[model samples]
Target: MSASLSVGARDLPRTAARRVADGLALAAAPTFALMAILVGAGGSDVGQMLCAGEQGLQIGGMTVMYMLMSVFHLTPWLRLIQSGKREAA
Candidate 1:
């Protein structure tokens, strides 16, 4: 009975988190598209942006930074998922 009651209590928070996730997912596409359009319009030698002597590469910097930041952003969701799996077991 308590477990079922707790499940009912969990639904509101889960629904709120789902809404936040949906919002971020929805926002991602337009943000990416705008960035792509701006980058495309501002034409440079995109190839040379990541060459042997081009300070390692513009893209390389962005990739490094994104990965570094993603760890912090993704860790919470990973823990949440793991906990859900544990609960199922």
Candidate 2:
């Protein structure tokens, strides 16, 4: 029907937006985790090498920032897991 088609057309953008948001939610955790791992492992030496001429730059800052980002991004994953548990129960 024309009315159904119109409704579906209106929902198309909303559905696309939801999918995009879900994709970002799924992507954020692993992206931040990888960043944190890389920064925590050998970031100090890499930072020193990169900023050889800079003064008083703390390499730990980047590691901490990435760690915080990873922590913050875990919320989406936690919510996802909670939803899964709810469905199972």
Pick the TM-score winner.
2
The lDDT leader among the candidates is: 2
Clashing pairs in 1: none
Name the lDDT value of residue 87 in candidate 1: 100
Which ranges of candidate 1 are over 4 A from the true structure?
A: 1-5, 43-89
- Residue 24, candidate 2: Cα error in Å is 0.7
Lowest summed lDDT across 10 adjacent residues in model 1 is found at: 52-61
Per-residue C-alpha lDDT of model 2 across residues 9-89, encoded as one tens digit per residue? 999999999999999988987898788777666666666667685434344777778778878888888988999999999
Poorest 10 consecutive residues of model 2 by lDDT?
50-59
